[model samples]
Structures are given as C-alpha cells and as structure tokens.
Target: MNLLEEFKKNPGFVYRIGTDYYYIGKWICKPCTDEAVTDCHAMYEMCIQAKEPANAALYFQKLRAYSEFALDIPYNPAKILQYQTALVEALSDADIQSLTDQLRHFHDQAS
Candidate 1:
C-alpha cells in the first residue's frame, strides 16, 4: 500500500515524500507537529484511562506544558520564535504540512 494509505490508517507515521507529506511509518518529531500529535494522543488516552478527575487534570497540565513549549507563546516571544524558526528552517514542505496537520489535531484534542 501507498504511504498515504498507511498514514490514513495511522497518522503517527507521517513522513516526507519529495516535496509532499505522507503519514506511513514511525517518526518522532519533537520540533512542533508530530511531537505535539503524539503528546495530544497520549493526553486523550490518559483522559480515557483516567479513573478520577485528578488524573485528567494532570493530563491537562502536561498538555498545556507541551503546547507552551512547542508553540512558545506567552513566555519570551523572541525565544519561542527562534526555537520555532529553527525547526521550520530545517523542515521540508512536506514536513511543515504534516506538522501543521498534526498541530491542528493537537489543538482539537487538547481542548
């Protein structure tokens, strides 16, 4: 099967294809997108497994922390921009797109 198909089955495997994006295999992106996706999914799962409100609160704390670090918004804007710029500079178009997709997912899942 094609990489797109694979990604459709499992979004955690998003990868680059020339200038395009495809979700297919194992790739852990700590920059902004994939890492965010992974963390968001983890949070969702934790929420699902939460036996008490305290556990869910812990997951929200973690989610907020991850998002803050990744987006770099509300704490030293210059530093956050630098961090995000470095990642964007190093990424291919495909990576950026995939990251964007994952980021959107992260946003939805986070809330």
Candidate 2:
C-alpha cells in the first residue's frame, strides 16, 4: 500500500505541513502539486530539518531507507550517494551525530 494509506491505518498521527503530509513516525510525502499526495520520498525534508534526538532518530530511520535508494540511482543528479555516506557516518556507532534514544515511541510506533 501507499505511504498515506499506511498512515491511514493508524489515525491522528499524520502531520500535514503545507502541501506535504509527514507521517510522524513513518515518512514525508512529496509536496502537493494539484496531483495526489503520493510517493513517500525516502529522504524527507524533515530529515534535513530534524534537530531533537527523538525526532532526528525517527527521521534518521527514514534516512536509512533513503540511503539505500540513493545507492541505487543510475544518473545520480541529486548526489544521493554523498547523502548516503554522510547519513551512514552520522548514524554510525561512533556517535558522530550522537544518537541516544532509538526513537521507537518518540513520535509513532517502533517501526
């Protein structure tokens, strides 16, 4: 199912920011453009804007999936590979970004 649909399974958690819908514990939908708000961009804008440890961890989880997608791109106009490396380093065991809580229930479910 789509990300929005997935979020629908659990109500009252999805956060709507401008035209996009950020599933607090899931992902951020692409900006609306007169079309349906579909396709959960693996790397969300919130991920870039995350600050708090709990929220960062949530966004970080999404970043992990994004990092994988980044490595699969063919043309690579978005420099996703660089982003992938940076995220990996930041979320590494060395605590480069200093991740503390796992963000399991910070915003949404453990997933």
Candidate 3:
C-alpha cells in the first residue's frame, strides 16, 4: 500500500520522506506551516513531563509567539514577513510546490 492508502486506513499514521512530513495525504512543514505552532506546544508538553518549570515557561512563550489567541497582541508584519522569507529560503523549488499544493487544497476545501 502507498502512503496515501496507509493514511486512509490509519488516520493517525505519520509519514516522512527525509525532512518532508506528510499526514492524511497532506504535506506539512515545520516552523511555518503545521509544525511550529505545535512544535512549541509539544516542547511545552515535554518540559512539563520533564518537570522543568523554567523550560516549560519558555516553550509556552514560544507557543504564544506563533498564535494570537494566546495573547491579544497583533502579529508584527515585519516579523511575519521574516518568517515567510526564512521558510521560503530554506525550501527547494519542489518543497515550495508541495506547500503551494497544500495551500490550494486548503483553499479548494474552503470554497
């Protein structure tokens, strides 16, 4: 069975092709797409499990930095752009295409 079929049979399955991550037939990336927001969240959880209060606080702060709901402050446009630049700079052309495909799929579903 292929990755897609594996995901369909088990929704919880996580597939990785090198640094590329796929879940439920969708491509996902870190620090900008589906990972950072939860990357921080997962780190925070780990801190909690490790009983490190200071580290937990730091991770929580990182989590909030990526999300508006965690705080009332609006995101800085420059910072957002910087993040976009970094993400795009780090990805190859094929990676960008994968991300674009994911975005199109999301928009199509929303429409």
Candidate 4:
C-alpha cells in the first residue's frame, strides 16, 4: 500500500522533516505540538541573543509569521501583545532606544 493509503488506514503516522514534524495529511501531529512550540521559542530566543538588530528583526518577523500560522486565530490582543513582547526583547538595547525615540518623535509630530 502507498503512504496515503497507510495514512488513511492509520492517520497517526507522523513524519519528521528537517527540524519540524508534520502529520500524514499536512495536519499538525499531537506529538509535534510540543516540539514545534519549543522550536519557535528557541527561534525567539536566538533572535533575542543575536548581536545584530537587522538579524534579530528578521527572526522576529519570521517568528511572528510562524506564531500566526500556528495559532490560527483572529487578531487577539493578548496574543499580539505576547508576540510584541518577544519581538521587543529580540531587539538590541541600541535598537530599542532608537525605536522608542522614533515612536516618541512620531507621536509628538502627530500631536
């Protein structure tokens, strides 16, 4: 029997691809959930640990995308805040200061 047939017969089969695990029919496997979460957390951590602001921002963007897909929900304030916190943490001190300054300038200009 083919893999599809096997999956239909027993849909519990999970396959690992690279660092991520996928279910038989492109579904998120139960066993992979924890691993996926851990991987995402690690990615976020790496972004925080990055020396370069650009690299950290790139990783934060990727992390946001991944979190969105994984969460599969509408715009939830709590979730958005969580991701924002992570992204903020990923920024270097200099970058954070610059961003804060820019935000303040923009706010002052708008007001």
Candidate 5:
C-alpha cells in the first residue's frame, strides 16, 4: 500500500502550520517515501523553527533512530541495511535545503 493508503488505514496525529498539514501518513502521496523519514523530517522542521532546546533534543533523538533501528543487524543485516539505505535517500531536495537553512541559522546564532 502507498503512504496515503497506509495513513487512511490508520489515522495518526496531525500537526498543522497555518494551512499546511504535516501529517506524514495522510496527505503525502509519495509512493517511494518512507513514513518514518517523512515524520522525522516534519518534526525536525517544526523543532528548528520553534527554536526550543527541548524540541532540538527531540529532533536529535528522532535522528538517532537511524542508528537505533539498525541495532538488529546480527539477526537480519540485509533487511536493516536496505531500510537504512532507503531512509538516507528519503530526503527530498526541498528537505535538504530547509535543513541547510536551519543549520545555517543555528550557526549564525551560535557565532
């Protein structure tokens, strides 16, 4: 099933910003996209914009899933590797740009 179909099957929580809905499972129709990656990226954007330490920590924790999710490599290395590969490729060009901008702003603030 596609992301939208998966979302329809299970109605998860929604986060809204103005008119935009950041609900990964529901609105996004991208067939190749992984739901976890989309959800993490969405939370990352919101956390960066909010400029709160707590949210920053949350985003960091979310990012750490890339490592945590791979901990079962001893049993099924190939499956985990494929998942990691897909997760790494899940970010779109716009997502990369937004992440870059957020990092730049953070650096500027630090300096």
Candidate 6:
C-alpha cells in the first residue's frame, strides 16, 4: 500500500513534515503550505495563555525545536527565516545560543 493508504490504516504512525503524506494523527493529508506556520501560531497563543512564564518558555522552546527539525533544508530561504524568527521570539539570546551550541555539538558527534 502507498503511504497515504498506510497512514489511513494506522493513524498513530508518525509522519515527518515536508512530506507529501503528512499525518495529522487521525488521518493523512496532502502537504499544507501553512501547516508549520499554523502550528507556530497555535503554540505561541498557548504560551501567551499559560499562567507561568516558565511553562510558556518551555512550550515556546519546544515549538522552536520542532520547527527546526521539521524544516531540515538549510538552502530553503523561507524555512531559514522562519526558524530564525521562531528561535528569536521563543528564547532569550543567551539561552538560544546555548541550545544551538549544544545541538551543534550533539549533531557533530552523531555524524
């Protein structure tokens, strides 16, 4: 069976972003141009509504990380810009830099 058919049969299957058959958990749909953008906005809203700044910061960081991992194409100008913007808005400079450094180190080691 094709990816869409497989995803339909098993809703829990994880689907990576930027693929044709991006799973929304319950079903698979064609790639949506604003999927990531919508996710970012939703997360941002949730963070804003959070009672604690710490919780807000945590979720914001998660959103930023997900965006980075989902958009792996460095050459894609739009993704690069979106990732940078999300990183900046979601984290303080020091924290974001620290996380970036740590991630880079981990990636280097894995390679």
- On TM-score, the candidate that comes out on top is 3
Model 2: residue 16 alpha-carbon error in angstroms: 24
Give the deviation of candidate 6 from the true structure as CA RMSD: 14.8
The candidate maximizing lDDT is 1
Estimate the Cα RMSD of every predicted model relative to the unseen true structure: 11.6, 13.3, 13.0, 18.0, 12.2, 14.8
Candidate 1 collision pairs: 7-23, 14-23
- Give the CA lDDT, 0 to 100, for residue 29 in model 1: 25
Every model's TM-score: 0.37, 0.22, 0.39, 0.33, 0.35, 0.30
Q: Which stretches of candidate 1 lie over 4 Å from their true place?
A: 1-61, 65-74
Q: What TM-score does prediction 1 earn?
A: 0.37
Pull out the clashing pairs in model 5: none
Those runs of model 4 whose alpha carbons end farther than 4 Å from true positions after fitting are: 1-73
Candidate 3: where is the Cα deviation over 4 Å?
1-72
Worst 10 residues of 4 by lDDT: 22-31
lDDT of 1 by residue, 10-109 (tens): 3233223233432221222233345554555455445645644455556545554543344322435345335434545676777657565554443444
Clashing pairs in 3: none
For model 3, the local distance difference test gives 0.42
Per-residue CA lDDT of candidate 2, range 15-83, in tens?
Answer: 333334332222222222322222333223344345444654555455445433333324442353344
lDDT (CA) for every model shown? 0.43, 0.33, 0.42, 0.40, 0.42, 0.38
Using lDDT as the yardstick, the better of models 4 and 5 is 5
Estimate the overall C-alpha local distance difference test score of candidate 6: 0.38
